[model samples]
Target: MSNTKDIPFSPPWQISDLGKPDEPKVTELAAGPAVARFAKMPIVIAEDDLVSRTLMNSLMEKWGFKAVVTKDGHEAMAALRAEQGPALTILDWMMPEMDGLQVCRRIRESGKMVYVIMLTSLGAKENIVEGLHAGADDYLIKPFDKNELLARIQVGLRILELHAALSARVKELEKAVGQIDDLKLRIPL
Candidate 1:
């Protein structure tokens, strides 16, 4: 007999009738304070599978993220290109119109600092290498563990934060250089 207290409480719809006995349950992925820190941060999800997309959206909401869900690569690209679009994106490998690799390439070519996470069933060594070369910041195979996914997302968030800080520092340094140049102009040589 299974211990009812050991199982996490999930909505009936979320619990698959044919789910494996050993399948891990989805628990609270983020701590309360951590969730508050990233609450309402938009994240784009590009997934062709309805079930997978729904699950991702649910998880994002539960973790206090604002999920901009898309069903195709084209839609994903559009969302990412929009003004004030999310810096973090989760993309599936194969989709109609444009594949995730193509999307990643486009994002890189456009010179945007978007962090892309390729979530797919392509787990081969070559596939992982190819995905990374295509400019994906991270790659995750499908049927992923919820905790692992959250950890990966947190990593992306930290990287993005660092990028933002570095960019700001660069701008400050440039302004200081400009000020020094002005001072040099005012001073006699």
Candidate 2:
């Protein structure tokens, strides 16, 4: 195999396209309130292929995300395990020192409420099922359309946000129940 760094990458879309008058710019679309809510949000990208990793990093950064790029599953896992780690991650199926599936399983076993997206060239039915079974929240094939990838990422962010909101609500309900129990204890029978 050739050195990943030596591999050339030509993205499906060009940065110049963003400036074209006939089409809407990514920045323009990302200026929405929803985008602002996720702006600069940290996200993990684990891809062994240099081209894919570079492309994902660029796209995530363009979309107002702070991408934490990793070359292998081990590094990805380390990033995910860090203090204040990102809640969203994109992982390629094949990688060195542990595949995406292993990382997914580890994440699940660790009981982290993370949103995982499997980005790989494996588009077969079984591969998709396997990835899902391994705890990937979403699966996207390679040579992916930037717009579609962005949409999927947005969905993951929304899901994470909802999870956070639900957790907070659960805590509030528990606190209220505890207070109610205390009140009941004080009341005369």
Candidate 3:
């Protein structure tokens, strides 16, 4: 006969002695698009929601890219200004203190060619147009899937690359003109 009070306790880590089923560990989803994997640059994500911010950050990391997350447009601006080297920004359309549209215009006015993608809950055509006019390279609506966001980001990166190429060509042309002016001075003009 066994005493009821004398039962030995089993360690929880003893897998064979377990009674209840173990709960499944949660795993974060990866970015759905392959383009995300090609990004080797740093990107800033400005989103107020904690869940969205974490999801975006994890996706960026999984894609082998560096990411900084901010709660509002103002913080995003500060990060952009302080960061060295190349960086891209993803701004939420509506935020406290400063909005995405305002941030985009401000960044454009600074004359720095940082790629910007605006994320918004406003999916209307007019709203998207407005965002475009505000200097956003691309627009994404809320509840967007990972693949859609990644694709839009690729578009912004391509546009930025083109802009950089054009700007370099213009600079080269300007330098040639300056050299020609020097040659003209040597000709006694």
Candidate 4:
């Protein structure tokens, strides 16, 4: 039997597995998303509930994404600051010390463009709008399905790719404009 233990970390659904004797473990950093496949963009997971956190991390690996897992908003913020690359984030709506909304707002103010997805059990329309206004790109309800979450992540990946392309194009245009200006300066009036 797979030995996963329950922990009494606040918010109830917390779990921790000691180890499965015959299984190989997945680490916090994986090559799937951060290597040749997902453009080296790490996905940040900030969930308070241990069970949910563990499940999300597992799914991320299976979905071919590298993850930086954080216990709460504070840790998530630290991870965001330290990641130093384009990254997508999954934030839990309710967490101790700092909630997801607070984290989302701070991320928006940082001026770094990252796709944020709010993971919550709250399915109300107003709640979703609140999350969006806080700067979340999308929202996923709890007990999420494997395939659906993967598809949603795929959408985020696509958007991130598009953003990167646009940024590159802008740089090229700026360089060309600079060259043109230099040539104009050399022309006789």
How high is the CA lDDT of each candidate model?
0.78, 0.78, 0.72, 0.75
Compared with the true structure, what per-residue lDDT tens digits does model 1 show for residues 24-49?
22247433233344444568999999
lDDT of 2 at 117: 95
Q: What is the lDDT of candidate 2?
A: 0.78
Worst 10-residue lDDT window, candidate 4 = 7-16
Model 4 stretches with alpha carbons more than 4 Å out: 1-36
Provide the lowest-lDDT 10-residue window in model 2: 6-15
lDDT string, candidate 2, 1-189, tens digits: 865232221222222433433333347354344444665556889999988888888887777667889999999988888725237899999998799999999999998878999999999999999999999999999889888888888788778766766676677779999999999999977
TM-score of each model, in listed order:
0.82, 0.82, 0.74, 0.79
Q: What are the C-alpha RMSDs, in order, of all predicted structures?
A: 13.1, 13.1, 20.2, 13.4
Model 1, residue 40: distance off in Å is: 1.8
**Candidate 3: tens digits of C-alpha lDDT, residues 1-189:** 865332222211232322222321112334333233324456888888888889889877765556888999888989888765445899998888889999999999988778888888999999999999999988888878877776676676666555655666677779999999999999985
Off by over 4 Å in 2: 1-32, 83-86
Error of 3 at 185 (Å): 1.4
